[model samples]
Target chain A: MSRLNIAPTKSNQLNLKRSLKMTSEGFALLEQKREILVMELMRLLDRVKVVQQELAQRRHKAYATLRKAASHNGYYHMRNIANGINYEHDVHSDTRVVAGIRIPTLSVKQGAFRSQYGFADTDSLVDQTMIDFLALLESAGKLAELETAVWLLARELKKTQRRVNALEHIFIPNYKDTLRYIGEVLEGKDLDSFFTMKMVKKRLAEAAEAAEAAEQAQLSDGDAPDTTP
Target chain B: MGFHIIGDADTVLGYRFAGLSGDVVETAEEARVAFKAAIANHRKGVLLITEAVEDMLADDVTAHRLSSKPPYLAVMQDIWGPRGKRRSLQELIYEAVGIRIVQDN
Candidate 1:
């Protein structure tokens, strides 16, 4: 692996070690986050599948019933009845946080159902169309919620995966290489200084021993001369 | 926060009867404008677009779908029913997650 362009020093080694530790921890956390996001995404995907199927069925039934109603009451008559409808329900939009994502949710506050149309004008076909469409709307709302959650979770998962890859493949390895390089350089410096110190100490001891030997010989020569005289 | 719709006349009117507000767009440009305005409103939590209008502004819809932002959009069939085969759950999951999920049943 290519090492980072850093000076191989003891202080740099310390810093690299700290950073490597932190990066490994961050990678683990991101990995966990990715797993959670995937799980959440899968759950939402399953729900979306169920909701989509239900929505398709409801859409077909609702539109078919609407076509029949339009044919029976006439298109203009159906439009008029729809315009005259005063029975409106409240849809409350709120958010639920899943894995730190704010997933929007829609709920219809069901109120008392009142027949706003006059019995003399509209037929039961109009009534059936209204019921079918209402059901369709409910399913559509649910599908929207699940699909949004899935999209958001998937996006977060992709981002987390990128970060994890960078740390696992690049950042952490670079730090480790730098640390090892610095460690080897420091050890080599220590070995060089130790050898030089040992040589200097040995040379000083040898020189001192030679000087003592010369002084002793000189004293012995002076004593021999005094005795001969 | 509230839910909104952008679609044709009958789809908009049908949802309006259910007490939801909507914008009825006749063309691609109109659909694009309505979608832009709808997403601009942070209070809009859900946007239900008819499949026909979605076809008109497919790029914009796909962009918003990938953005993972607020005002989630769901395309539904108009009163006449879906024009063509809508994307299956597997296809949608692949688009969102980039993984092909094999359906067991």
Candidate 2:
């Protein structure tokens, strides 16, 4: 891994160490969040699969009944009957948060079917189609809730994964490399200074000894001259 | 928040019979426009789209699905039938989690 382009200094090393600690902690937390998000996503996906299957079956049956109604009553007549339906159902949406993700839940309040069209004009098939489709509306709402939850959780999981990867692969490694580089540089500087101090001390000691020897030699020579006098 | 729909004519009429309000869109461009308009409505709690419309605007629909926004979008089968083959649950999971989970069942 490449080291950061920072001066190899004590302060820089300390800062890198601190940030590395923080990044690793964040990476751990993000990994935990990712796990939770994945679990939530899987659960939601499972529910979605079941609800989708149920909705598909319901829709198929409803459409089959609709096709039968249209064939029996003629397309234009069926369309008119459909237009005559006045039932108004209220769909309520509620949201709950999971790991900061808002998952929406939808509920359909089915009202009692009021037959607005005349009984003399339409067959029982039209009523059946209406009932089937109405039932489908509720299932559709459920499937919507599950599928949307799955999508939201999945998206969040992806984002968290990205952060975790960046920290583990890029950020943490870079900090370690820079810290090691700074440490090696500092240690090498200390060794070089210690060797230079040792060399200077030995040279100073040799000079002091030579000056003492020269002074003794001069004093001895003067004593010999006094004796001669 | 109320429920809204964007789909083909027959699907819209069917939902209309159930008393839910929706827009009938025929082409991909119209569906895209209708989808944008429907999402822009803050009062719309859930936006239902037929599978056919979803196929027409797959990218937009997926983008909305992954976005942390409301109204929530749900794709349902139209009167015609299921659109060919859809992405399996496994594929969806892999796309999101970046791992393939072997089903125990």
Task: Output the number of the lDDT-best candidate.
Answer: 2
RMSD of each: 3.5, 2.5
- Report residue A139 deviation for candidate 1 (angstroms): 0.7
Model 1 error, position A175 (Å): 1.7
Interface RMSD of each: 2.8, 2.2
State residue B24's C-alpha deviation in candidate 2, in Å: 2.0
lDDT string for model 2 (A1-229, tens) is 7999999988998999899999989989998898888888777767777887888788888888877877898877877776667655666777888888777777767767767788998889888888887878878778777777777777788889999899999999999999999999999989999999999998888888888888888888888899888
Question: CA lDDT, every prediction?
Answer: 0.77, 0.80
For chain B alone, what TM-score does every candidate structure achieve against the true structure?
Answer: 0.84, 0.82
User: What would the TM-scores of all predictions be?
Assistant: 0.83, 0.91
Per-residue lDDT, model 1, residue A58, is 84
